[model samples]
Target: MIQWIIPLAFICAGIIAGLIGEKVIFKKLKTFVTEKEVPGSDIIFQALHRMTFVWFVLAGFFWAILGSPVRPDIANAFQKILTIIFLYSVTLVLARLTSGFVNLLVRRTEGVPTSLLSNLAKIAVLILGTLILLQTVGVQITPIVTTLGIGGLAVGLALQDTLANLFSGFYLVISQQVRTGDYVKLDDGNQGYITDINWRNTTIREISNNVIIVPNSKLASAIFTNYHLPAKEITLTLNVGVSYDSDLELVERVTVEVAKEVMQEIAPELIANEPYMRFHTFNDFSIDYTLYMRVSEFFDQRIGKHLLVKKLHKRYHQEGIQIPFPIRDINLHGN
Candidate 1:
């Protein structure tokens, strides 16, 4: 009964100490998280909430058991159990921290997602922790490692498609050719903003809000144009035709004025230093020329075209600039 009393007291004391430490650490962490507002503060707070008191209690429990008089075999078994729990807890904590850090990084980087990498990191941590635990408890892992090595080649062959996609995803991530928020067009006429690249597919969101999922392996091999690269700004040309009788100088002046107005009102930042037109062709109907302007990106070109056409037509109407249509003259001879 006396022996039992001492052990019971020690165990209770350990639990109480753990609870106290938990509250104290949590309070401090809360303050720090609130004050600092770091990227992974929530993850750190949760980790501390679980680990701080649990570790203290585990330590106290171990101390209590060691201090009590017990058989050597029982003591050894208890110590092994404690060691396994400690290892498991440490692995869990590390995995969470790693995943949190990765999530933070994902937010900072473009075109990178965290789910796949975070899960992979956690799995790796658990596998390593399991192996270490097994070794600690007198289980040999060399045989298991050898077996995995031998089977890896067969597994690789069986999962050829899956492996290809996985490697392609890795390559896409490293290349940075296509990135989030950038507009891209595939050779087959599919165009959209790249949203994410996961283990098997890359997600692109089109202007219509529809998502296009292309296999990572295919995306890696496909020839595509990235409009956001080199620069986000793009040049757009609008072909216009004025009647041959109209004055070319007046036409250029009116067109340039309207373009400058559009630039200032619609896409001031996107337009190039100058808006100009070139008289390039003479047809049977009207003189053909091309109006050149710049836009912020692919999407902006649509708005650019709309505004320029509307304003140019209105201004042309006011200035009496004649836009001609194709006309054919039919003549007949009588004998």
Candidate 2:
């Protein structure tokens, strides 16, 4: 009964210490962590909460061993086991904390690749921590490092395409030539808004509700037009044709007026710019001209064009202007 009571008392003490950690220490720590709102700190605190009980148990274990009549060899072995557990737990916590913090930083940052970097950071921390832990447990690391070094060359050769994509992705992000939310069209006609750049491929979302997955290497090498760069403001041209008999001055005046109104109503941002028209050529049926206009961006042009055409058609009919279609006349002298 006495033997059982001694172990029970240690266990009970551990439980009480765990309760204190939760009620007192954790409460204070929680307040501090929440106030700071630091990226990845919450993850660290969560792991710490679970470890609190284990920590108390370790302390109780140490005290129990010191006070008991256990043999020297058994006690030393138990102590080693406890120390190893503590070290490994610390390693795991630090690794996760490091990775989580990097991820948080990436989300807040602009123009940086998040998922790839986050994963690389995690793998690096784990590898380094594993090496240290193995050394602590009396395992030599030199042989392992040498083995990896030899195998890496072979792995690189086997994964040439994958490595090409990975490096290209790195280059793309570093160069900042192409970026998220930019409307782009490739030379081969695959055009879309760049959505995200991942490890193996870049995700492009087209205006037609389709997605195009182009490999990073291919995207980097491809000649693509980024409408967002240089400037988002672009010039839009619309061709106009009225009957050859229509007044040229009146045509310009009415066309400009319609364009100005459309620009104002649909794209107020472009209203300040003056619209211009040039009579380029006299076609067989009508005089053809081009109307030059300004729009905010790629999508705004659609609205601008729609409004301008609709308004111009109605305005032209009201003014009795004729937009003649093609007409053909043939004279036969076969008699």
Runs of candidate 2 with Cα error greater than 4 angstroms are 1-114, 125-140, 270-274, 330-335
- Candidate no. 1 TM-score: 0.77
Residue pairs with colliding backbones in model 1 are none
lDDT of 1 by residue, 1-335 (tens): 68767777778887888887777767876887778877677877765566777787788778878878889899889988888888889888887877777766766775345355666677788888889889989989999999998899899999999899888887877687776678999989999998877778889999999999999899999999999898788877999999999999999999999988888876787555688999999988989999988777889788888999899889999999999988888999999
Question: 114-223, model 2: which lDDT tens digit per residue?
Answer: 45565666778778888887788788999999999999999999999999998898888767677776789999998888888777899989889799999999999999
How many clashes (backbone N, Cα, C below 3 Å) per candidate? Answer: 0, 0
Please report the candidate that would top TM-score against the real structure. Answer: 1
Best by lDDT: 1
Give all candidates' CA lDDT scores.
Answer: 0.84, 0.82
